[model samples]
Target: MGETNVKLASINPDAQKARDLLRIVIVGHVDHGKSTLVGRLFHDTGSLPDGKYESIKAMCERRGVPFEYAFLMDALQAERDQGITIDTSQIWFKTEARDYTIIDAPGHKEFLKNMITGAAQSDAALLIIDAAEGVREQSRRHGYLLHLMGVRQVAVAVNKMDLVGYEQEQFDLIEEEYRDYLRSIGVEPTFVIPVSAREGDNIANGSKSMPWYKGPTVVKALDSFLPNAPLVDQALRFPVQDVYKFDQRRIIAGRIESGRLKVGDTLMFSPSNKTAKVQTIESWSAREDFTPPSEAAAGQSVGITLDEQIFVERGELISHVEEAPIETEVFKARLFWLGHEPLTAGKSYKLKLGTFDTPVTVQKVDRIIDTSDLSNSESEQVERNQVAEVTIRSRRMLALDEFTSNGRTGRFVLVDKYDIAGGGIISMEGYADQRAMIMATKSTNITRVEHGVSIEERARRNGHKGGVLWFTGLSGAGKSTLAVALEKLLFEKGYNSYVLDGDNVRHGLNANLGFSPEDRAENIRRVGETAALFQRAGMLAITSFISPYRSDRDRARAAAGDGFHEIYVKADVETCKQRDPKGLYKKAIAGEIKEFTGISAPYEEPDSPNLVIDTAETPLEECLETLVNYVERNFRV
Candidate 1:
């Protein structure tokens, strides 16, 4: 029972597996008694390892220090003497209502990242204010932080009541000041109860010392915290972590961030645009006799074997075919800067959102908010511990959702050098984030590119409507073949058209790019923008790429403006392998190539396409006729 180096209490398996488990984090300023409150909760709930409490008490006695509940949180005697938690720690505690995992977050401003790490993973938070100290700067800062991290349910614990002689007046004053600041930031506390974490008064049970108080005890208040809204109701967002090829079975392992996934479900990977059907629902110890789960919902780490082995890699987001996340590079975010240096505009930092890690720059400092006093104003740069609204421009397009849409996938961190310097929740698309590129285009246009040619003018001049014919599907799915043959048909028929074949375009235009998720996004972006320019000049830009990610295809459609048609060249894996004109699927199957689409990587089919040509079934002449006829009826006179 005497567990040493215990991060979590050994709880009953039944309690551990309960669906009512809630993750609550204790956060506040240094020496404000966050650890002590949590330690008291654990000890009172009978959650501590046997003799662990007594050992801490004995150590405090031998060192001539008073035995405090806070002592149980600090591993080293020096840490307790210093009266500050240096790192984040988690402890398991159960109550009459539900089980809890209380995260102890350090309160020191320097350890802000540690606190943020804890707060980010939490469902709710208990913000502590030292009654004796009477509303310090860190108290206001932490409270404001909890709001930014989207911890909606916060209760203020007016700790150290014994030091204030258990006076109700002292508790009232501190609660009033903190409550006003919290209101300014749009947060209302659930409760502001006075407590002495050291003496364990008003903790598990109500305090008799404060006879005027008639509210719930610490335990009662904590038990009132509601369980988080289940992510099953939302759209799916599973970012691939790693692909495991153990023996002959290739399993894509990841946690479902939102929605549910079932066997035989069709999944589309974003930014890569790869498609696969769930062949099997796999767990770590899954066997032939394994009873498949009905469906793996949000928060479950699962390994899924696809019907077709499409090269899915880390950074690609798996989504439902009907619904997909947005893909963009420029977005607005509300971030709290924790870097030692100020977050200055024009400086590049690595922005990690889900599996997408790309170098990003602070294009504009919209404004900065000082959490210390809730004072906000427009600023040129964001300093340490200051929250700010800024425009971020990533090096490549990233699949993303608004924080309000999905917190797990919607938040990102800014890495300066090697350390994670800032964290933020994406607010919305920063259309202004494209300012730098726009200004550059303006500056470099010796020919003075103009938007004088209207859509109608372009269409009339082209003889056929000017637009993009975007062929998307797996490699060797006849996308390039169809696009080339279609271009030949249109050319001989005396209409302005050109084929931007994936291979030929890559050789010249995207020679610097590779097949990674980031590179693929950039490659598509360039092709899309280039196709748009060609379309504007009244030419039908027929572009063919695997373009497996829906989000990327959507972005390409966006760039091409109106009349961008998506064509799905349908072919199953076996058919595509048999027609492996490039010998890529064979190499990928043999493990000679990594992240190769249609074999190891994913090829997401168009969720809804203008046309679906079964290349495996239809003859080349018939496929050509169907494709050309559709284009003529839709785009021709």
Candidate 2:
């Protein structure tokens, strides 16, 4: 073991306060010793509990699992059983200079979603490359993801030195190759360490096996890391996370993305376009008019009290009044697709960027770039784990910042109706006009075929204004029956209502659609758009479908906009079979209908639905009453 040195001057108590904590995530191909390296570091620093190692070792032996360094990182039982890291495991350790939180990210390609979640929160990354195997697919994939996530700092660790006979030549060759690869993607490693994590060589202690190489140990290199300061010192960016109202005072809790914020400063809330003066800087401790923004820079969570009771919500940005935020409906972004399904033009998905969640569609498949070849591929779609430069058009305006400027506001994820399928970074903002121009060029002939009445006027004539009532459930479930029943009931009550059933739309509106995942997506998209139009016309639109995919439901919600109401007619598959509204379940089980939802295809229940009616338990009258009350509360007369 190398002699440990303590530099008291290097350890500053105010160091943690000076800037946001720099998070470094360790990512690499599986079995490359990422977890082992972390465990070794923890073990050397005395961070792990006393009997934890012994217990893990005993468990590994009993399970007949190969006791590698990665076993220490198998925190989850699933990870251990699968012999892979399924999720990112956060571990905190203290060095002589700073307190570091190391995120151990999984390297499996299937778990890229987990990797993105971990990398998004990191300021820096540690790329672990196995010297024996060189760079694998995950190593390259994660590298691209990190770059897309705006992680500026990176370090490379060449593990398994003992297997390579602790040869300096092998380490040098691998280092040069990886350096070239990273440099191509605009990332330069700070340091590369060659050490045997199994033998405790040069990780925390200096290794005698490799005497020719002379460089700082991994721990020393980490301590030497200096955080990058924010660019604009005068510009304050506060992204409101939540509003807390206690008694008579309203407190806004958010992290300052950039610049200085102080009490008595006038701040402007965007999207809502409201202005208010800062009353006081509220935190665990009460501060006066002198709240130094420098004292709490970007990424540091803080609370603020405003002078006026202005309406604000999570995802809204509050900044200095002079530099009001820009909101746009369309933008150009660099996207990395991770879903099993490919990303195609005209496909809709839920766009979750910052705190704003909206319905978005891919207007065009701009260009697909192969990360490995660095060449353009002329393809109609982007497949799983592929990186591409594409343009996205959102239904509503979103306040966005460039990836180079502010990562917090620039990064976004595309949820396939329910599951997050892709992650992207906003490269350019305010591309709505460009998209409009493209749309104009595509439409050679323009014809005015007005319905002769405005949507508001039509709704007024209908008695009850237009809105979308989405019904979701299992295949054999009474979603369609209930939807039709409700529409008839609304019609009898002097409300104009229309039913958009799966069977009805398949005959004409969705005639081109098939039972495939892609076709199902298109089916949902068409229904959602139609419902939106009906709602605009002031007619109640009831859509009933076995929209098994959550992503499809999310897209419908976004298309329907503010008046969209999602109702989950919750019923078990067994109960659905008992109902057998269309005799579809029997066909599905008898192999007559392939890709039938609730049989072959999956049905993801809505996570945050507006209403949930258990058709199995609730009476028809009671369910109808509950739905009526919801409509009355949500839709104003």
User: What are the models' TM-scores?
Assistant: 0.67, 0.61
Question: How would you encode candidate 2's per-residue C-alpha lDDT over 63-107 as one tens digit per residue?
Answer: 787666566667888877777888899978776677788999888
lDDT, residue 494, model 1: 72
Residue 521, candidate 2: Cα error in Å is 35
Question: 1-637 in candidate 1: lDDT tens per residue?
Answer: 1212212111123543554888998998888888888888889888899999999888878889787888777776567657779888888888879888888899999998888888888988888888899888888878877888888898889998999899988888887888888888888898889999988888897787889888898899989989778787889998887777878988777778899878888998877666889997666555568666546777677778899978887778999877877766667788989998999988999989886688998877877887776666987788898899887867676778888889888899999988899998987531312212222243453684567878788677667778889988888889888888999899998779999989998899999988776677667878988998887778889999888666578878888877798888988989889889999988989998877876655455575888899988999999999998998888885
lDDT, residue 208, candidate 1: 76
Per-residue error for 477 in candidate 1, Å, reads: 49
- Whole-model Cα lDDT of every candidate shown, in order: 0.81, 0.76
Regions more than 4 Å wrong, model 2: 1-21, 54-68, 230-234, 242-260, 280-305, 429-637
lDDT score for residue 155 of model 2 = 84
